[model samples]
Target: MRPKEFVYHRARDLDHALALLAEHGEEARPISGGQSLVPMMNLRLARPDHLVDVNDLGLDEIREEAGALHVGAMVRHERYLTDPLIRRHLPALLEAVHWIGHPTIRRNGTLGGSLCHADPTAELPAMAVLHGARIVLASTAGRREVAACDFFKGAYMTDVQPGEMLVSVIFPCPQGAHSGAFEELGERLGDFAMGSFGVVLEHEGGVIRRAATVCGGAKMTPIRLPEIEAALQGQTLAGLDAAALGDRVTGLIAPAGDFQVSAEYRRALIGELAGRALQRARDIALNAQP
Candidate 1:
């Protein structure tokens, strides 16, 4: 199905995009890579009367600002996944990007687009939740920063206002040396996962100081399992009890029955995925030590 008639604006830059959004209000939609939005439009799932295209804007740069990494909203998944700086600095993100989609989709999918779309099964949003990433949203009013923990309100929902656009994503640099790993299980290779887990761990003087357990496809939004997180901190990764850990996570994420996987099945897989993800992170961390 073709979308209804709409106006299109090719924004010259950030200011142009902002102006277009402000003028059109909720009737306007921003199109970056068009990977996600195009499909939705084709199905009539989204029927925006105006499209503010930022493809002309030079917002694809990825650079280090102060102590953290700043990725422009237009940056493509392929560029991020292969960037040397991203691999060295935000290893967890690199791990997560691989699970996004196949190479073709990655080439056209922008980071900002994914976060704004907010699919519960998406890997990037789950990564943001795990690492405490910050989102910079802009509008004609001013700019506002929303932490990942508070940005996602529900499945396919976010705190972005009608006239605001997600400008960039900020990832705080690691305070101490850390290792990151991600593991996911899907019905098919490259398909959305039944359950995906991302782990980021920091070790100081050989003792685990902090760890994050970000789970996806288990709820309405990607969630950082606090119950599981509380148990893992300071506990040596090798000493993790799979059975016990499984039970704890099961209670935390009693997945509601969905068409993809049964609640019991999703609950069961979370434990397995969490255990393996933590173990991989530990191995990566241990190997990095001198």
Candidate 2:
């Protein structure tokens, strides 16, 4: 099915886009790469009365700011995969970006688009939460920063106000002894993960000092394992048993099952992936100290 009739407005800059959004309110939808929104429109899942084209907004650059990486909203998945800055400062992003869709999809799927799309299991949002990333939202009024973990309200929903657009994502440069890893269980290379996990580990004196762990695909939002992270604090990586962590998470999270996967099975996969991600993070924390 084709999308309903809509007025098209080509925005030339950030101010133009914000003005268009403000003028149209919830009736307006922004389009960048159109990977997610176009399909939704085709299926009649979304029928905004106005299409605010934002490709010319110049929100596609990757740069550093105040010692952190400021990734523009229009930065495509392939851009992050290829950009030396992203590869160097946010390795977890690199690890997860390659798993999103395929080359063609990555070539066009925007980072801001993905975050705003708010898919439960999408790589960027899950990894962002794992790395304690912040999302910046902009509108005609002003802008505000939100924690990645708090950005999502539920599946395909976010804190993005009606007239606001996601301008950029800010990732703190990893400091001290830290490492992160992402892993997921999927039926095939490009399929949605049955279960996914991302982890950041900080070590001191051969003991875990801080941990950020998040799971995806199995819930409406990425589930950060703070209780488990608290449990693992100060634990030596070598002494850390995967089964123990797996069992602990399995008991804490109750993910609802979809048609493709059962809740029981999803829980099992989440438990297993949790261990795998933690182990990889531990290895990096132990050896890749910078």
Candidate 3:
């Protein structure tokens, strides 16, 4: 079915977009790539009375700011594959981007749209949580930054209020030598994942100094494993037990069953993916050592 009749307003600038949003309030929906929203609208899942087009608002640049990478909300997924800043600082995101839909989806899907859409199985949200990124939301009132972990309230929900638009995301640069890996299992190449895992390891002298892990497609939102990260601290790469860590993850997460798979199957799949991601991350860190 086609979307309900709505007024379309093409925003000329950032302020214009905010004003449009403020004027329409909850009745307005700001659209950029429209990869996620348009489908929802087509299915009548969303029926905003006004559509505020933000594609021309100039929120599509990627740059390094202070000690973090500042990625404009409208930056497309395709950029993640080629941007030097993303390559250097957020390689895991680059890796995960490869798993997103297909070439067409990657070419048009915007980072902000994906995060705001907040699919529990999406790779971008899981990457944001793994990187400890900050999401910037803007409105006529002002702007506020929310932690990535807290920004996602649930599937298809976020902290973004009715009158606000996501401006950009800020990811802190890794301080030392680091490596990351992303792994997932899906029914098909571009299908939504059955389970996915991402791991980032900051290491020195073959020992883990810092670690961050996140899982997707297994919970309400991307789940960050702080306890697992803490357990990895000071662990030497030579003695790390991937299977044991996988077992620990299996015990910690309780994934709900669905039509595609049973809860126990998903739990085991996530655990295996976590172990593979961790092992791959460790190997990459070791290879980078001088």
In every candidate, how many clashes are there?
A: 0, 0, 0
- How well does candidate 1 score on lDDT at residue 147? 98
* Model 2 per-residue lDDT tens digits across residues 215-253: 897679887888988988889976877677978888888
RMSD of 1: 1.5
lDDT tens digits by residue: candidate 3, 50-143: 9999999888889998989999999999988988889998878889999998899999999999999998899999999989999999999999
Candidate 1 per-residue C-alpha lDDT over 207-238 given as tens digits, one digit per residue, 9 for 90 to 100: 67887778887788999988777777887655
RMSD values, in order shown: 1.5, 1.6, 0.8
Candidate 3 regions exceeding 4 Å error are none
Best by lDDT: 3
Candidate 1 — what's its lDDT? 0.85
- Order of models, best lDDT first: 3, 2, 1
- Evaluation by lDDT, superior candidate among 2 and 3: 3
Q: Which stretches of candidate 2 lie over 4 Å from their true place?
A: none
Candidate 3 clash pair list:
none
